[model samples]
Target: MPLLRLIMLALAYLLPLCVWADSIVMVAPRETALTRNFVEALSSRLPTDTFEVRLLSSTPAPDSASLLITLGQEALHWRLRQPIVTPTIATYVTLDGLQQLHDEVRPASVQILLASAKPERQIILAQLLIPRLDTIGLMFSEQQRWQTRFWQAAAIQRGVNLYSRGIPGQDQLPRVLTNVLNQSEVLIGLDDPALYNAENLKTLLLTSYARNRVLIGPSAPFIAAGSLSTTYSSPENMADSVIDMLQETWRPAAIRYPDRFSVLSNQQVARSLGLPPPDDAELMRRIHAQEQSR
Candidate 1:
């Protein structure tokens, strides 16, 4: 049956294509440079032949989509309010931001890619930058106090002490920061906008600089504004991370930080503190080696 064999071969090829073909819908709160860059980066990398990616403009997401991706917190909130049942991957949200919405009813299947790096990674970076770094300072808002335990555990494992202060309100920041800096060699900025916003970051940097202690762990933008160093993921890095997750046969619903990142340093700040820190490339290599060893 030559005809039957031809039909079977055609079906075999078509079946795999049908099974692999996935439609991905990306939704963002609004059109912005950040969203545009991410979309462009993702589009360039995703295999056009197998994946169909579209930007969602309105609600009632297409039912044919194999997956939905929300670009930011606002988009994610909007999607959560809807009744769509497609599995979603929410990006550009910090751990605390996502936690704030955890109590709200959401879709059954959702995952998050955190905007911040792991606390352990931050601690390790600090340790690498500051030799014999024993005591590390952390100032967190009341909403982020629960995260201190994770930071403390990471510090303890590395034989370093974490001196953390919780700020009940913005008014208490000056006092809390003073106390934390007095006890610790360096301050590690947590990923809380309430504590680390533009209005507050300048003061934090000035205060830490006055104390001759460097600040670490804020994102790349802060590095330009006097933060000593940080590990950050760019749009391309995030797109690659999403690609990795998509390729996985089974991606469980979990909150994860980007596995790939680039290290940045403020040579001026390092010089001002009289600290000779490794260059960005070396620091990244060391961090990678440490992660691999773990």
Candidate 2:
């Protein structure tokens, strides 16, 4: 909640008479540590071709920026229908802003995927795994214990083992990972700092392979390391896309799901794990497709 009263420090760079650049104001409901960090990142990293940015302090009046990015649900509610702006949007994921400007309707599964970030990666992995395989195992344990949700009636209806270490964190992670690999075929890398922080990927995954197990998670960085496969996304891809939509015109108010998680695997990784390595042509095509979509 530290960024709540943030004033537009960068707006001064934007000049009047609609200067050569488009000025954009970013609004978030509260002054969160994460929000402040993002503002810093955006100011330095946002594409210069189309934008200049301002920070709005929850004041209702619209100021400069050609487009305003409202972060989080609170901002979404207040800004979208402001007697001034129309249907901005509500992006619950990234927990970034609540602009009434979102106009894309995404699948429920995709929404869950978007909402699942570094901390709650396990939850997202559970959603994807519980529906596809039984006896899914947590390589390490921490914030989200899968048993709670997976044990529910709906989950029971689906039927799968929601296994865990019972004892989680740095001390027990390696053995726990070993145990989970023994108990199940597929492993979920939940991004718990205690387990994933300093562990090198090649060794951890090779250990799973020795036990004849597979691994999957949301980081593109992992796939290259030796895990059987992984799903990938970058903040910049989504951020730039949203900025472009807001600048051009008004559309539907909805969540735009990431197209698909990138799948990464090598012949050795795939073969030993029982997955046929995806055609290199297909992989290249998919990567190209993502570039074109952007």
Candidate 3:
């Protein structure tokens, strides 16, 4: 079995190299740290001759490139407008963003790497920390109603209850937050600026802290601010996932999140809330194991 598995893995990697071993072009709306970091890390992992960076505003993608990687919404939008025959992989985009892009380009050959954590991944993170997790709370903008439905089903599968509230607007946040906070043991943060922007994040974090409710953030900044932990992937991880998909001989799934992830924790926040936080390495190990089991 071990020998067979090794052969299969070898074939998977080699097949694509044989068929489509050509330069990759990565496009983004603008130059940013994330884009720079992804290109650097991906270059190290892939062949030195295999990748080049192109900005949506400045340079056109080279015709010689076999694969196209787009970062962020602007780049994805730009790609959809063009007639692209090459295989495209989009990263650093939300689930909603992917859906929106697909609406514009159906029968889309472009694959996606969503920024949001999968429901199972988020639930596992919560369950690992709070073993007795019963009622989970979430706040979402009207645009994210689909997420609430997803979590509701996921929670039931895991023997957990989900309490969710939709934010009609930013003005009603305090009232809606108080209502959900009262019913939930942990509050999940979605990656929506309308609901969790810079202007309201401090209020949300402080309120969660005062309520003694565990706040699960969607990104590193949230974990840094006051969230006990956040489930996200870094740019390098995004690059790695994209590279893996491109190394496939055939077109893969149209939409998916990066297989790699990071679980970041703030020990001070955890300690203040009277919770013990797992070390970063240990937490990542557990998360990857959970994903593999699924």
Among the numbered candidates, top lDDT falls to 1
Best-matching candidate per TM-score: 3
Cα shift from native, residue 234, model 2 (Å):
4.0
Between prediction 1 and prediction 2, the one with superior TM-score is 1
Show the lowest summed lDDT stretch of 10 residues, model 2.
106-115
Model 1 lDDT, residue 166, Cα: 92
List the candidates' TM-scores in order: 0.87, 0.49, 0.89
After superposition on all CA atoms, what RMSD does each candidate show versus the true structure? 5.9, 10.9, 6.1
Tens digit of per-residue lDDT, candidate 1, span 1-294: 366544543343334323443677788777888888888898887666534444556554676565678888877787778765556778898777877886777544677888886788888899899878999999999888877888888888788988888999888889999999999999998888789988998779889999999899578889988899998888888888887766554344577887777898999889989988549999988987898898
- Candidate 1 regions exceeding 4 Å error are 1-21, 49-60, 106-108
lDDT of 1: 0.78
The deviation in Å at residue 57 for candidate 3 is 2.2
Per-residue lDDT of model 3, residues 1-294, tens digit only: 366544543453346632564677889888878778888887787777877888877878875566788889988888777764556777888866654654685334577788887776787788888888889888899987776777888788778888898989888999999999999889888767678778998889889889998888867888877788877888777767876776565444467878888888989988988888668777778878967886
lDDT of 2 at 53: 31
Segments of candidate 3 deviating more than 4 angstroms:
1-19, 249-253
